[model samples]
Target: MFLFRWPVCCFLLAFHKSAYVWAGYDVSEVTCSQGLSECTVADEMPLGISESDGADVQMVTAKVEVCCKDNAPCTLCLLVDAELSIHVGEDVDKSHSGHDTENDREEATISTASVTLCYKTPPTFPACKRVDFTVCPTELKQKVAKVSLVITNPAGVSFSSIVYIYPSKALHLIEVVAPSLNEVCSQNLQKSIKDCYMPTVNSVINQEMNQVELKFAARHKVCIQYEADGRCQSWESKTIPLHSVTPCLCLQVWDDDKPRRSQSCPFKNMGFLQKNVWQNLTASVRHGRMNNKGQMLLWNLSAPCRLEGEVWPCRWTSGHHCTEIEGFRQQLENTTWEQNSNVQWVKMGVFEDINLQLSPCVMVNLRGGGLHLGPFCSHHIIAAARWRWNLLAVAVLLVIALAALMSCLRHDFVKKWASHSFRGGCAEIGRKGHVVLLSPPDIHDGFSEVCGLGSLLKSQGFSVSVDQWSRMEQCNLGPLPWLHSQLLHVKNLGGRAVLILTRKALGLAHEWSRQQPEALQAGRGDGNVPQSPYSDVFMASLCLLLVDKRQGRTGERFLLVTFDQDVVQPPGSLPEPFQGLHLFQLPSQMKTLLCELAGGGNRKVDGGKSKAGWKWGILDGWKLKTKHTTCSQGAIPTQCK
Candidate 1:
């Protein structure tokens, strides 16, 4: 969460910008002021590389200053966790050729390192704290390894800052003779073509210095890599080269515009060097080794050019006049007519191998030409492989996360784990114990009965809570866990819950519930009474039972309503806690059952109906006749009294 506060406007500077809110309060303001000196990698930090149990030693620190709304009522407690990401280079596909410093490469790997930048809750807003996240390898050999610092707050806001970190290996710019651009054409002519190394260029190539300057043929630019102050500045241009084959930079040959840290090689294309203002005007080679060496050449020469003098043929993505054009193996040699005469160029060839020339590949900045293939060292295959592996690992983690989300969306089963239990109070004492009806929406008959039962109970002075009626709108804020909390609240009120069983409920339960009966026999052919409930209903019911068991409560305050001729014998086993304990099992009985449960009622039942309920069941039946009822026809027993 990069926060740039516009107090009145209330804007947060991040990918998602909107009115800011933290916890539940409206955000008034947020500000960040960096320290006098930003955190950077230093050479003094690591003497040499050391691997501990197959892991490289890391050594770097990260810091930041964060402030929340100052005029708020109290200090906001922010819980933070951090991650340090370091970029490492992957191999240029064998089909192609390449490019970071050891630690400053382009592709990255999340450290196996366990690092977290943490601090105590700020006693005041606008807090300043120095957080050290993780250490990264200091032996960066690639061009520039990218390092990013990410800090996440519990409220779900994340702040990320990335800085490029270079390796400890020193960089040197040298001018070496390039391979003949016409090697293939020359070999065809049987001409023994040899390299032409300028005497001045050869001397500059063998020099053992930390920094050197060089001069190049006109109309070209060079990308130089080196260390200034403490950090690595890789591939930055100190001169400018141009297209259209004009000699504008050649005009500066006498300007005395010496290269300090001040030159801007903006025109493009450069090569060859020695140590004066003119020498500073050219490019360099990788400092240490030979194979890791570069082909000394400039980039972005305009057209009056073509491959075989036809179209611009090079493997790298190229341009015709400033418009980029490319495809797999789409070379200038293969392009048709008009396209050939129109190609414009940007970057050209690069760091030359002092001993190798016009090899199968010219070490050009495949992007253009104005580039420096990293330091002259054997490309580290291990580093490249690890970088690719990191990408795969991240992809796997994303797949797992996506799957979990899909589960939560398709069924209530997974939603039950959404931390709803953390909001305790489901068992608060004082209210009368109520009956909870658990069933799905598809089971119209069962849900109707459950609702009827609830009405009957309310008439008897006992309260009732129905899972479906809890304003699903408000509860949407939470998942099945929140809905389950409501059901548990009902259970803890006093009486346990009642589950309406049906083939539809059973089939869904088979899929959504964590545990199931050893076997299930379908009751689909039974009757019109067996209506299936919605998955949401099953979700709440299953969670209630599980949550109840987890709380370790006492008593079997539940009742199971089975609707078979022999409703006493259920088709499958019931979910635990409600598993086995002789309690009133309503087998095809409805109102009479409610009366018996409501306190002042007869304890006798016959043929799945009360012969004569004795008290409340009769009165409730009469009340249903006089008042509104969900199902009126044949619902209440006519001979209640």
Candidate 2:
């Protein structure tokens, strides 16, 4: 049985001899037998791989081939570029020289495997070409993706070092940096759109995860609405919407009030980076008031005084009810206070809660409106104070100067009044006169007759001397020997002497010698004189005697006139020397006594003309008449009528 089994196995083994699986680098060359054509190796031969487009993958026959043993009928099969399951498999038989096996149930194969990926002779990538890729879904964790890249090179050659890909989270972040991703993400189109939603990534920042930052610089229209109970309206709402249909759509920060106030709300989701918010927003901010209070800077003032009309009211309105406001502002020096219109008083420089990350702008809210506040300069305060001082000084000086001027004027008026009172209003008259009139002085001395006589005499071109009068009695002279001297001197100077008689003088006319001669002896006795009971004959005698003496000095005229309203005393009804003197009828005070003397330049009078006109005075004869006239028996003669 062993011999028979051996013979059958030997026959089967001899029939089932398999071909040797030989696979290695191909080392073949085409040759010319007759030594006419040059032989070339496969490496030197031109494969279509060298002439391929940068985007295509053209297969080149590798230096791998299948070989069989001598004279043995065998099958030889070869495979090139063995790869992973993810790759599109390409089975290429470089050569087939072996025959099929005796069993022929399964085909025999041989292949060569090398370091090959999806690579080209001259490797390059498309705009968004994905290179190494891997998806790692670790247990109980978000799946992490990994990707790697190779630099596209011009030279068609493999790199020396092997490449590797590690798991990373940055693969998702890389989408933002891709060239294809940049084309779709542009800037904001409408003013209502959120600034951050429109990405303007100038530079990539975060080398770390959450810290990946961007630089954004642009302006946005923002309007804010105040919460009913909030203290600050500006701080709460950043943007306001104009379109009523879309309350969230914000087109402008400020708008014409004609369409009424736009709906405003808090916009916390603005995507723009706040890094450049100060720089971008500063230009649009104006010098504006928080309340009605003027936009004023802090210098030094009362903390919470009522500004009234000077500032905007710090209040808020809801329906018909206005509420008080309590708020703080951000500034160089932070302060806080209440508003008056809002029911409390507030100050200009006030601040709120602060931190290191402060922005350049602050919110200022008042009753009627709210706005963002920008920087203001308070440096002019010092200079303004100086100006105020200067103005005050000028005003004080003006008041002082005006007071001094008024005082000077008052003193001048007092001095002038005193001078007028003391000096009286009359000019001084000395012993220089061409016509002299003797008359009695009265308490109320100024009379119309005296003034008319003086004026008439002056009009006739004679320098007349009468009484120089005043309201005071300083210049008054009572009858004295000096008066007698004045009358005699006037006669010596060829001046006229006129005697005037009033009722008082006429009643005591004859007693003139007894009363006045003693007064003359006393030489201007007593500034005042008492009235005396004297005879009219005595007065007439004295006047006659005086006239006789004065006429003896020169042939000047002696005017003796009786002013009696009761009777017309004719010149012939008089005593001896006075009988031919100028005698005329004179009504007491109604008319002036004018001695119708001579023509102009005659300088003479009718001393003794009664009914006969222009009779010259008998000077020697008047002395004879005065000697014959006696007084009282011890008295002067009464009268010869």
Candidate 3:
């Protein structure tokens, strides 16, 4: 009985040792290759051990790997390795493996375990190759997602684990820089589209992310309303071609489907710069008061973008020699906008009188792009103040010189006026009522006519001083002394002095008086009283009288006349002094002589016929009787003695 009992017990024990038992399963470990989760998964997972069975079993772990493409959605892949544990009765073969089991009847038997994944925070995520998680959410706190994973065993029991998935850090410091004006004009379409780039610091930080390039769209148009607003109404929305000479240009950039803010008016200040340049150039050329002393011209310009260029001030000399101004050639650096310190003050040397003009020019290279832009200069040259002042001074000097010359030429007229003013008043000859008729020598022809002329003048209210009237005085004072005294009296009275000129006296005007008693002749009116002294004094005065050039062919205080018998006498035949005097033919010019003694020379008499009617009648009768008496004496009046 012992032997049979031992065999059965032993078989039962062996069966129990060979059989597997089912127990509650639990996930020992989980692994996720993606680092965006709150729960950590180990690299190597250790399978759980069945305590009663005394056998080790390994449970497969899963790796949650993520794959993404470009800026599109990201994918999350769950690769699971699962093994099923099954429990068999004691009759089952014991050679299945070396693993032993306990007496628990429940077991997980399926070869495959079903895994279900769902998100709690984020409702949906893309599948293996197409899954996408939020990289950057609107709220930073919502960037994390709660994911639940369940592993179902063949025993119908479920094992679940919760994981928090936080999205990976995304690119945050990205920026787009637009192309410059130089690139816009000079670059081709393909190169221009690729010209836009990220900011320097941002591109350095995100080296891998920087591979994602941006595209640009440029619109060239005029900025009509730049002052108040940027209103560029372009007719066509399509991109226009750009050139260096294009006017009123602007630019815009695009990033992917969305466009970035545009950078317009790359050359907005160009017009203002050009206007100021012209003004400065014109001012530089103009000559000032101290232009020859040299000066300085400052060039201050601004730009929206960086620029590289050269500038120079030039001078054109009298010989058409063109040369740059001294100390004014400059190479431009990266000049920026709105910086006052960038002003370049150029000093110019002394501009000689031979300099014809001056100007300045600027050569612009936009953005240091090597392409050369046309030079800008002024169109018109400005006249200098110093030159204008010089011309005015010369003109004034010429006018002054001309006036001086004219004054010198008319010195006689001016001298007379000055003398008259110096004397304190005008001469009152007619008002003095005094006249002197110095008689000719008694040997002269027309001696009676000479005496008659004095009488005729006496009838016209003149106090006539004549040798004939003054015979008693002449006989008492001797002829020479009396004659000298009468001449002196006429000068002191400011009176008129008349000398009756005859053909014989005029012919002997320049001859010396013969002092011999035989040469002396008695006057017909003198009654055999030899008047040699009177003749000598009269002839000497005639030779001394000379015409004054200053007074223009006339004397101030002398009157000369010839009788009708000497009518053929020409003024040129007389002495120099008498030539300027009017040769009056008697009776015809007798009224004119009266007008002369009345103060003005040969001027119109307002009422000579009525006021001097008696004088004219007596003078006409004397003239008619003298002519008749001479004709009766057998003397032809037309022929002078």
Candidate 4:
């Protein structure tokens, strides 16, 4: 009988303890699958009883749980020691049914008691047999709930514990204050290109609020709906990193099972650098008005995003110098392009001269990135009046330089051209006759002056030979023999002879005359006596003069001429045969000389008879002068008519 009774008592004790174990559990002590409870334990709070010194105090341990299972309603379960001695105040019973006299002192009678719960204030469940409260799954959607439980004993002793319950579907948004896009770009500039990432805009969102929270999931996205004609036209979604988030874009949170929420937009306000947004931006540039400060470059910026800041930093680079345009930023914020205004016309900078050749550009703050809204270039602006004046000045300088060059070459060029034209029979001479020019070797540049006279006569239809050009032939044939040959050739061609006389020539002639009288008296009148210490050509000329004078020959075959630069000796100072001949000064008496060379004695000649009746236009002013005067003769001559 004692063994059977002990086994029964053990079975009853085991059953009693197991009853409360299912209702009340310490989640830390037990795994979720170890329990007989069908609900999955979402959260649990344990209120462990402290050791009590007072015998009146009841020993109690309590725990609460928010539990749910696969799409089912959530329940708030309160678990407590079922063996605790507790009774409602009004329903207390003093009588006790003792299990046995020996066991009555060790175990207290289990009493029926009520537990009350209150949540969200004013909503209370009182005197409940079971401590389970049914909660709709949608009621606690992704949120936390705090519940308060109150247990009262028959003696009016009250015990209470607060339980924080989290439902199975509860979610929380962890707010993270991220760096702005500008700061991210700057900090990651040193990173490798393979590691560097640039975020592209997914969609343009119109946000009504300035701030909201983002819900992070497997796929983080920004979604926006564009409207047209009062209806939604299209939906745009973009994948973006957390760093690229801004208040202007809308966020959508979703999962594979179901879309948790949609239209969560205007993300939490992340401070931005307005200057950086415009740094990589593109815009149109225009020239600004010129003021007292100078000419300015105007940047017109119209963007969909908001631009608001105290300053916009930029650099202006020209050549090797870079200048910060900080003043323009202040000017931009203060001018018509106000803060929060999307459209702005900003004055980039001022330049002293717009016509400078410098190609200045505006550099935005984005250094490594490609050209943003600009390096706006500056162009040279030249006024019409100033350009015309510069052109005129250049033309005047060219004309002056050309005149100076032509002046230095005129004498030599005309001399060579006239000689060539006469040789080619292309001059006005037209192969008319021949003439010989005789010049004394003692005067300065006397031979060159005689050559000039010869060239002019050659152009007037008279073939002329001067001693300067024949010096090589004169060296081969003696000067006297050469002079004789030239005279014979002139006589055969019916051409006259010219003696270019100067002060030196007359002096030499006086010396020769004085010596000739001594020679004739010495019985040597054959003209072989040394007359003067002069060139053989000069002595030969004097010998010819002597022979003509002694023979009493008239000086019709010979004429005397002088250049403007030479000192013309008076005809009375000349010898007998030379004094009777007409002494013509060239260029002034050139027509008269030509007439005499044409065999017209004392005849007046008008050279204008062959005029082409056309004036030279502009070139007439540039015509070369002969001797001290220009030639007055026209194209044709009437000298021998």
* Top candidate by TM-score: 4
1-641, model 3: which lDDT tens digit per residue?
Answer: 44444344444333323112211223222321111122222221112211212111123333343323344332233334322121222233344344534222112111111122211112333121111121111111322222222222211111122222221121121121223333433433322233333211100111222111222324322211112222333222222211111123333333334222345444454543332222112112223333455443343433312234665556534442335656645666642322222122222222233233354333334333354432322223212322543476468556755775586578664565455445533232253345667655532235556556665665555546665444423422345666556557666655566777655455445232322222333311221211232354465345334423334634445666667454335556665546555445675567657656655333322422212211333345435234422211111121112
Best-first order by TM-score: 4, 3, 1, 2
Q: Which residue runs of candidate 2 sit more than 4 Å off their true CA positions?
A: 1-433, 442-446, 468-489, 513-529, 532-557, 570-580, 586-596, 599-641
Q: What are the per-residue Cα lDDT tens digits for candidate 2 across 251-305?
A: 2232222222223332223323221121111111112344655442222111111
RMSD to the native, candidate 2?
A: 48.4
Candidate 4's C-alpha runs over 4 A off are 1-431, 520-534, 564-566, 601-641
Weakest 10 consecutive residues of candidate 2 by summed lDDT: 632-641
TM-score of 2: 0.21
The lDDT, on a scale of 0 to 1, for candidate 3 is 0.36
Q: Which stretches of candidate 3 lie over 4 Å from their true place?
A: 1-429, 443-445, 512-531, 547-554, 601-624, 627-641
**Residue 193 C-alpha lDDT in model 3:** 32
Preferred candidate (TM-score higher): 1 or 2: 1
lDDT of model 4 at residue 126?
20
TM-scores for all candidates: the values are 0.24, 0.21, 0.25, 0.26
How many pairs of residues collide in each model?
66, 41, 5, 3
**C-alpha displacement of 128 in model 2, angstroms?**
99
